[model samples]
Target: MAKVTLTNMCMIYDKENNKVLVQDRIKSWKGISFPGGHVEDGESLIDSTIREVKEETGLTVSNLESCGVIYWFNNETGEKYFVFQYRTEEFSGELLHKTDEGSNFWVDLEELSNLHFAEGMDERLSMFLEKEYSEGFGSWNQHQPGKLQFQ
Candidate 1:
C-alpha cells in the first residue's frame, strides 16, 4: 500500500521591512525553508499551521491566508505527501533563542531566491510575494531522488 502524509508550511512575512522568517533546515532535509512541521493525526490544518509556527518561531500567527495544497507524488512507487501552504503577516511574540528544527532567521524578500532552499521553496516564495495576498495552488511529481517534475 502507498503511504500518505500531511505537512504544513507558513511564510511569516514582515511587510514593512520586506523580509520573511525562514528556517535553515539541516535535518531530514537540507537547505532553507519556512518554519513548519508535520500535521499530527486528527489535527486541523489551520491549527497545525499555527502550532508549528509557534513551536518553531515562538510567534503566534493569525490572519493566515491559505496559499493552497501541494500534492507530492513519487511517480515510481506511487507514494505521496500533501503539504498545506500558508502565509501570514499578523503575529505576536518574541522570537525564540533557538529551535530544534533548525536555525531560524529573517531573510530579505529580494534575496530569498538567491538562498539555497529545499527543492521548490524558492518558486513557492516567489509566487507568494508576486501575488501579494493572492491564493496559489500547485503540484509536482518525483520520479527519482532529488529530481522534481512540476506540472
Candidate 2:
C-alpha cells in the first residue's frame, strides 16, 4: 500500500487579539506549531481539528474551512507528508496552558516570524490567515520526485 498520512486541520482563533493563535512548541515538538495533530483512524479531519483544540486548548469550534496543505521534508525524522490547513472565522472558548502536545499561546500575525518554526509552516499558516485566501486544498500528486501539486 502507498504510505498515506492524514493531516489534521488545525487552527487557533483569538478574538482577544483579533489574530490567529499560535504556540511555541515545547518538549519533543519539532518547533513552534499551530495547535493540531494527525487524524485518527476512522476520524474525520474536521472532527480531528476540533477535538485536538479541545484536548489542547479547551476551545470549541463551530465551523472550520479547509484552506490548504503542504508537502515538505522533515529534517528530524526525514518524514514527508501533506499538512492540512484550516481556519475558523467563528468560534468560542477559553484558553488555558494545557496539552500533552505543547505549550499553547496566541502569536501575533505580524510577529509570527519572531519564533522558530518547522519547515513550510510559515508559508502555509500565512495563507490560512489571509482574508482573500481561497483554494490550495486536496491531493498533491508528485509531478517530480521532489515536487508537490495542490488543488
Candidate 3:
C-alpha cells in the first residue's frame, strides 16, 4: 500500500515593495523557503495554508489565490507528497523575526535567486510567479534526486 501526505505553502507577497516573506528553516528541509507546513486531518487545503502561515509567520493571511500544486513520489517508499501552493497580498499582524522553524524576513524578489534555497524550492517559485504553469511533479527512488517539471 502507498501513503500520501498533504502539505500547504503560501507566498505572502508585499506588492508595494516587490518582496516576499520567507523563512530560513533550521529544522527539516533547512534553507530559505516560504512559511508553510503539513495539513491537519480534516482540514481544508485553504484553511491549512492559512493556519500554517499564522503559526510560522505570525500573520493572518487572507484573499488567498491558489497558485497550484507540487508533488513528488518516492518509488522506493511508495509514498507521495503533495504541497498545495498559494499566494496572497492581504495579511495582518506583526511579523515574527524567528520561530521554531527558522528566521522569517522579507526578501526582494530579485535577491531571492541569490539566497540559499531549500532543495527544489528555487524551481518551485515558478508555480507562484508564472501564470502558465499549474502543476509540478517529480518521481524518484531513495538514492537519487527527483527531476521536477512544471506544466
Candidate 4:
C-alpha cells in the first residue's frame, strides 16, 4: 500500500506593503519558506494549518483563505504527498526572532525569487501568489526534481 502524507503552508501577507512572513528552516528541513508542518492524525487540514503557523512562528492566524494544493506522487515507491496552501493577512502576535523550526522574518513578495528555497519551493510560492486558485500533480523523485503538471 502507498503512504499518504499531508502538509500545509501558512503565509502571512501584508497587503499594504506586499510583504510576507517567511522562514529559513535550519533544522530537519533546510530552506527559506513559509511556516507550516504535517497534518497530524485525525486533524482537519485547516486546524493543522493554524496549529503549524502558531507552533512555528508564534502567530495566531485567522480568516485563512485556501490558495491551493499540491499532489506529489512517487510511483516507484508509491508514496504520495499533499501540501495545502493557505494565506492570511489577519493575525495577531509579537513575532518571535527564532523558533525550533527556524528564523521568521518579513520579506517583500517581489524579492522572494532572490532568496534561497527548498527544491521547487520558489515556483510553488509564486503559483500561490499569482493565481487565485491552483493545483499541481507531480512525480516525486528523491534523486531529482520531479515533474509537475500545474493547473
lDDT tens digits, residue span 1-151, model 1: 9888889999999999989898988785678988888999999999999999999889999988887666767666666787788889998899875677788889888888888998777666644565543333333455344433333
Off by over 4 Å in 1: 132-143, 146-151
Tens digits of per-residue lDDT, candidate 4, 81-107, equal 999998898998888869988899999
Tens-digit per-residue lDDT, 1-151, candidate 2:
3455676656666666767676566654467778777788999878888887777778787678777666555444445565667887577778867566677777676777777885446545555766344434323334423333333
Query: Comparing 1 and 4 by lDDT, which wins?
Result: 4
What TM-score, over all chains together, does every model reach? 0.84, 0.72, 0.95, 0.91
Clashing residue pairs for model 2: none
Instruction: Give candidate 1's total backbone clashes.
Output: 0
Q: Each candidate: how many clashes?
A: 0, 0, 0, 0
Better of 2 and 4 by lDDT: 4
The TM-score obtained by model 1 is 0.84
Q: Candidate 2: where are CA atoms >4 Å away?
A: 27-29, 72-80, 131-151
Best candidate (score: TM-score):
3
RMSD of 4: 1.6
Candidate 3 residue-wise lDDT, 111-135, digit = tens: 9889899988988887888756889
